[model samples]
Target chain A: MKADQTLDCIGLYCPIPIVKIATKIKDLKTGEILEVVGDDKGIKLDVPAWCQATGHELLGIEEQGGEIKVYVKKAPN
Target chain B: MAKKEKLTIAVLSGDLERALAAFMLAVTGASMDMEVSMFFTFWGLNIVKKNEGTMKSKGLMKKMLNMMNRGGSKRLKLSRFNMLGLGTWMMKDLMKQANMPSIDEYIAMAKDMGVELIACTTTCGVMGISPEKDSFRSEVGSLAGAAYFLSEARKSGVTLFI
Candidate 1:
């Protein structure tokens, strides 16, 4: 999928990947899409929860080959 | 957008393991756009101690307590299995292998994310820790009492006492 930016946080654990994602999301323009890939055990829940709390739109979450991919659309500030 | 949820984390342990665990929650909460704060009380105040040593030889018991918390956060031990400080080392290694941010890094991020770090005035007094002379980090939001924490928690949707 097309994304304004792709953040590869694979191998990073909880809070780090999410933290990186949170920091990167701020750099995107409103309506820009962010694609994040992480293999942390908690990434599945963490990504969506982050989106919910930050008022962003979680367009999709996919899992393949034991990796998690999350698509987030930047919310208008 | 709906009003962001507010979270209050009460860190009541000085153990490295527990303190790191609680900070993980605080950092995550703050990143999620929540209004997050932590009340550092009792033994937990050790994490913010700038001075390594206090009145060590004042009394036998106080001396022992001072020895247990002689240094800053670096001297913190795991709540259990702290054999010759090996347990603390093991945990840090594990955190490293897991690619988790170090405890210090998490605390710094929480500060940057605007997480309020409050030291309990009563705890400091009871523990003979002077908030003024202790030289805690400047990130500390306030030296406050239970009443103040209670008021904040009353307005918080999520309150966690770790």
Candidate 2:
């Protein structure tokens, strides 16, 4: 999916990046995709858990060259 | 119109830096018109103590050690304290000099701003920290556990663990 907004949370640990992403997503319209790039190994689990808990849809997750990319689509409530 | 936001922060570290971060976030959230709730657990509960001495300052050497070992203030992570009293004193002084608000001020601001403060019941029970009749701001509420805070956090637009 094409992202309407991209967020780079690289170098941030567990809760900071997640908090930042959540705050960002809250400001976006439903169906807008937020692409998150981070280097924290825990983001692999943190992002998905946050999406699941918050009712947002995690479109995809990929790791390349030591960086993890997450695509999340804001779900309309 | 801009929609109102909600943020719930679970601050479980007992470290002074983490406590300051939690307070800062609480203040910021309130300033932004966000409904904010903070859950204090584990060592984080120390800040909610009735006694003024609960959040004290430490010595320079210990402060330096904490900075070196815990990655400094911006990290907002915990530092291991061999002697809790001295460390707390040092931390309180350092935070004071840095213009960081006291726990009392944070709680008062939170109260005036409608921020919720929830102490972790289980941690308090296990650690023998009492919350009853405390000087904790009148806005402070009863204790809760991780599950309670997490459930509340799940409903918030922003949830932070500091």
Candidate 3:
């Protein structure tokens, strides 16, 4: 999937990946998509949960070679 | 716009792992755009002390308690497998390799993210910890009673006691 920006959080653990995503998402325009790439298994659950809790949209998730990729769309306030 | 959700965490343990969990949750809650507050009481108060070693206090009992506990985030031992501090050292090494922030770093991150750190007044009194005397971390914004924590917890979507 195409994303407006990408954030690589490989080698980081839970909360760090999510924190990076949250911080990076702020730099994008509303509705712009952010692709978060990480190896932390926790993100598979955290990304969707965080997006759901914060009013963002989780577009999709992909996993290849043990790395997980999550796509989130910024929410309109 | 909707009001941000609130997250209140009570730090009740001085264990290194538990302290890490508390700060991790605090920072994550704040990163999720929630207003977060951490209430420190009893043994948990050690996590916010400015000093890591034997604290000066009046009376033999208070001095002994402070000396044994030595309240500080960096001085905390693990709840399990402490191995006379070896386990904690290993844990810290692993965390550093994994890019996990240290307890002090998490505290800094929480403060920068505007997470409120509140020290319990009752615990302060019982443990002879005086904020006015610089016993507590400067990041601690308030010294409050249980009523303050209860009110904050009542309004919070997530309230956890660690």
Candidate 4:
């Protein structure tokens, strides 16, 4: 597997962070992983819900030094 | 089979909160690479009107109503648009300074982003507004009825009535 692509979405509000991440993931090739970084408390649920709704795969989620990181893989349809 | 997922938002309220929320959702949906559509009907069409003024509040009760007008509600009874208030003017200026696009800008952005804007024909006819009138964009789809809007909503992965 290649190194995951990272998307920093900190400081943005609801929908904006999700929107930015979605836009970034669309340009990536299938099987490529995306690392989404954000601090929105809502994103902890919002991102996963969005990924599930849009058919994207959520690989993992972790917290490091107070920042939240979401791992997503572009799933093939 | 994996089906393409899209979102369609039906804006049926003309409240400021509803309009802003719908615009935000549309911008977000487009950014998400989802095909999004906004159906403007009833008072909701006011947001798209070129001549419409900003929402305003006068008394304490009215101010409370103004703050509550963010999201479209099926039966929300709020104060009318404030045509002569510093608050309304301030709100517009604040939105501009915040880098938030105006309703008109959002409509144009939606077009550029391939988001569909559908006007309700029934409402337009009742209000005596014509699509050919000045300031209305030709890119707006035909005035559709509730049935048509609902049909499109059924195909969308997420549908919002704002």
- Stretches of candidate 3 off by over 4 Å are B52-56, B131-133
Model 3 DockQ, alpha carbons vs. true complex? 0.85
Compose the digit string of candidate 1's lDDT tens values, residues B41-94: 988888876644354334566567656656467778888999999888998899
Q: Candidate 1 chain B: minimum summed lDDT over ten consecutive residues — where?
A: B50-59
TM-score of the candidate numbered 1?
0.91
Q: lDDT by residue for model 3 over B37-74, one digit each (tens)?
A: 99999989999988644565677777777767777877
DockQ of model 2, rounded to 2 decimals: 0.03
lDDT of predicted model 4:
0.68
The clash numbers for all candidates, in the given order, read 0, 11, 0, 3
Worst 10 residues of 3 chain B by lDDT: B125-134
The TM-score of chain B in candidate 1 is 0.87
List per-prediction Cα lDDT, in the order shown: 0.82, 0.69, 0.88, 0.68
Place model 2 in a CAPRI quality band.
Answer: incorrect
Instruction: Give Cα distance to truth, residue B19, candidate 1, Å.
Output: 0.6
lDDT of candidate 2 over B37-144, digit per residue (tens): 998776666566554323122556534533343321222333655264566677667766655566666667667767888888776544454435352434667777
Q: In terms of TM-score, which candidate is strongest?
A: 3
Candidate 4 CAPRI category: acceptable
Instruction: Compose the digit string of candidate 4's lDDT tens values, residues B33-107.
Output: 678888987677666555433234345653454344322222222345545544555666776765556656666
Give lDDT: candidate 1, residue B70: 60
Worst 10 residues of 4 chain A by lDDT: A1-10
Question: Quick one: how many clashes does candidate 4 have?
Answer: 3
**Residue B28 accuracy (lDDT) in model 4:** 72
